[model samples]
Target chain A: MRPAKTMKIELKVNGKRERREVPPSRTLLELVREDLGLTGTKAYCHSGICGACTVLLDGAAVSSCSLLAAQADGAEVTTIEGLAADGALHPIQQAFIDHFGFQCGYCTPGMVLLTKALLDEVPEPTREDIVRYMGGNICRCTGYAGILASVEAAAKALSTKD
Target chain B: MRPFEYVRPTTVGEATDFLREHGDDALVVAGGTAAVVMMTLGVLRPDYVVDVGFIPELGPELDGSRSGGAGLRLGALTTVRSIERDPAIAGAYGLLADAASQVANVRVRNRATVGGSVCYGEPQTDLPPALIAMGASATIAASTGVRTVPLAGFFEGPYETVLQAGELLTEITVPLPEPGTFGCHAKFTVGSPENKPVANASVLVRTDEAGRCVEARIVMGAVGPVPVVAEAAAALLAGEVPDAKLIAEVAARAADATDPQDDLRGPVWYKRRIAAVLVERALSCALRKAGNGTR
Candidate 1:
């Protein structure tokens, strides 16, 4: 039998520093959900076609399922669990509830994280911008109308709060 | 997925040396977007995954030292998202930027590297056709020495590149189009915008002050095993005033150059027809973009 190889990686997950010894094949999704117990990041299409495993890697939205934990070493990772502050729902998360952003809620984490990334980049995005930027995060339910409204509401809410 | 040992080298030289020692057993990954997916699907089972993402020299940089000559140097690790958003690149190579923005989606673009995209040798991609049309060249690093290859001749076949074992694609240099030169990329997707293109065309046309075609380069993607250059189509446009009739003929010739395969995107015949229409659209768009500054 061949001996399995493991590599030690250190990364900042959700503003908390984390260190782990993971195998080369261990994906960032696996590390976050299994090892770190952060299951908020879902894994859907591991081939990167679907955005169910989206997360913020150094503030940019990326598919965590297609990324290796070892590859993210020394980088900062922001999962869905990182969004809120001190027992409060993030404005983006609340906006989803206010606007029915999801139905089954399977793709909410990715959609919310991607929304965070889009809003951070484009503070005041037009409807067209919202549609284009959020095209990657697919939701089989809610038909995306609610998601679009949620994103628009989130943008407005975030701006007003600021 | 098969288990493998991961090795991260902080320098290109160190990465090449490790690759040389391991030979085919080592697979070099830049962004790990494609590699990780392949690894998970059991399509790639390398014994050693040599990650070059840690190599600072290969990281993102937009060196315009050749700005005097209107050339640009892009490091291997330049993400597709950066190419789409970088003002400098967007200003000089808008066609490349537009094509980069069309790749997969925001999440994939955030992680996929330009070098990784080219090295992956996927025919149904966007960047290669535009890069080929822009007359790009790849700088490859090896333990033996360094070499440069024109981007047009880089691909050997589907999922294959001319890069030998232990070699690394370190940089891509694009010679900016001359004045009065305009380019456009037209892609036909099956349904969704993020889906792989069924047939795509990139046309770069340079016209003289009198509106006579001085040079033209037409490249087709997703309709061939590799990015296919429509030499005959380009030759037809050379020294001619591009009228609708001439453009139509050129587009037909461009379609003739394609060798598409039946895939989930579309069948071969449909791809050929779509390729022709896309070529026509791209050529017309490029001609219209000349001195107009509207794409």
Candidate 2:
């Protein structure tokens, strides 16, 4: 059997454009963590069942672990590393801190990213919206009460932003 | 996952050609939600992945477009979230929207395409039975030409469909329900909110002016190799007013039609029981929506 050829592809990651030659089997999670050195995006379950590897692709939240890097070619991807700007934590991040949204912090990155996507789509989400949008991203610690509160607080903070 | 070659076909013709050339060695990936997961789990190993996700025809946002007198046409690439959030779908085809909403979570729904879900042919999925109950048909295109397969008969078995080697599912057209029709989909999930259904049922009911049952479609999913249509159950509701006793009978018939197998979700008998319960609940919900309460 012959070795598979690597393909060169470009991606817009966290406002930065990156070009890399990767094997087809390299997943978006691997691309972010390994190639891009953005380790904030955690990979708990390599399969799609867990939302620990969630990222925003073109503004839609998707499981990065289940998305091949080749499929994300020429696409804009936003990981947890992308949320902070100019040494300032994003409002969602601040809200998570204030509410103590996470205990172990393993699922924090994915949760925060998913919250960013949800807030972008629905700036003023209701409790139900928060639950539904954040349903995929599981947090074993805190039992989700703090996470839900953080999302609600973030939505309020975002709505008040000038 | 084993390394493979990726090919993004710009056109359906090109995609079909690749599929034909590679045959079993190639797999077509749309959203990559299911395909990527399966591949990473070593369940599927295709040497070549034909990605049609970038095809313009498949990427355009779905719009409300009725075909002649044939109801709404949903392009194959329509995302599950798109269907779940579409107001037109929510208002008219609530069963479909409900089913779409219940699939996995928002993230998966954002990436999983409707065509991918249907083509995956997983018996436990929510769309098959809901679409089958809605009298939906799929338009399949290939190197030869195009043909439509009724969604009810589209499935051959678990993870199997009537789609040929080189055929691509282009669109799924759901006919306008009869003027008096109302439907609902009920799914019973045992574990988390994102867990696959142990048993699901979709019921479409059409009542006459006098509130008598005129037509009905009862479909049970996740209990068999394919979405099982309770033909006998549906027949029992035709031409008569539905009562609690009749609904129970129909539900029993639907349960009897199931060929459930013991799996991680539940035992066969448990799923059979859930199927009966879901059928009754779905039928009652549909009736309530139709403004006809069971007597």
Candidate 3:
């Protein structure tokens, strides 16, 4: 009915294709942070409700904790590590830094990426829309005003960049 | 989480074969939002997880160019966010797009597929009522091959589906109502300042050239094991402009007919009261849009 434990998984992480044997019981979050040693994608709740474990699976945001490492075969994954290019932060990441969008910086990675995605799609999202889209991303520090401001500013920056 | 073998079958046939063999001990995970959460909580202990995410046959099916009498034929894998952005879908099925736009959050919506939401078969889920109001149907595939089930007859009970052990949902087709028709969905979620509908109401109302009510479909979500259709409510509003008297009468019938359980959102009495308020507002919204379309 099921394999014993370990399973072979192939994935493209951070622009590099990798093949590794991982435990069937291990989550994608564990494999990302422990086995592959890419810790930029933070693991907070280890549950689907928190957005701290968010990662881009084929350009879509998904909680890594909720996925099995063995299920990632032949799939392309991009963590926070993959966002910046050539040592320069992506615009959204840069916007967070400029706007001081974080206090403890635990939720910043996921929030920044989520904001980048929403602004990429919505462009001129209203304040209500921004809040609604970011509902699942919990920010315990900084009270979310700066976070919202950063996203709005980033949206303006992104629109001008285009 | 229980230790399990996670298999990714690239094709539908392969998935079907795997499900047929391992149906009893296996769980088919598409988005993994629910399954993984359940596994971590030890709520589910399936030994084998057959992932349906990578199957090409179940990808988002959107019509890019506007075609006549055309609506969306959404593949089971189409994410809620993807549905929200599709131009033709927004133009034709605004109520669905509205519902999709408001589901979960950017993180969850990106991973939550339309098929997954419908297949959830949860009585309180937000999609079934909207789909029923829009006349949506799904193509389910089993060992016997493909068959279409109207969104009406799909759900059997809470967390229960008419889907057989090895059956797979392939597609969901939502018919676009007549151009002049209007649809609205209002949900009520507690402790949310955003005025997000707590006990959502999804309604479809239309009018003829003379402003007479042509047809109507009013469905309430989050109140029953399945989205409840208001047949009597529809009959009362048919062939009539939705006036205050009609709205009051429909509201009264809804309060009497609906069997909503008391839960966190509100007590049964509160829900009954909100349903009356919501149904009237929903009716006005639909009628306003129909009037606007005729203008």
Question: Which candidate gets the maximum TM-score versus the true structure?
Answer: 1
Report the Cα lDDT for residue B66, model 3.
25
Off by over 4 Å in 3: A1-5, A85-89, A159-162, B64-71, B192-198
Ranking by DockQ: 1, 2, 3
TM-score ranking from best candidate downward: 1, 2, 3
- Computed on C-alphas against the true complex, the DockQ of each candidate is 0.57, 0.53, 0.49
Model 2 lDDT, full chain set: 0.87
1 or 3, greater by lDDT: 1
**Model 1: per-residue Cα lDDT at residue B17:** 87
Give one digit per residue, the lDDT tens place, for model 3 in A29-107.
Answer: 8999998898888987766767898887777777899788776677898888888899988888888888889999988
Each model's lDDT comes to 0.89, 0.87, 0.78
> Which scores better on DockQ, 1 or 2?
1
lDDT of 1 by residue, A52-116 (tens): 99999999999988888988999999999999999899999999999999999999999999999
TM-score of each: 0.96, 0.95, 0.90
lDDT of 3 at B6: 75
- Residues B28-126 of candidate 1 have per-residue lDDT tens digits of 888888899998999988998888888889866554453336587888999998888887777668888878888888999988999999999999889
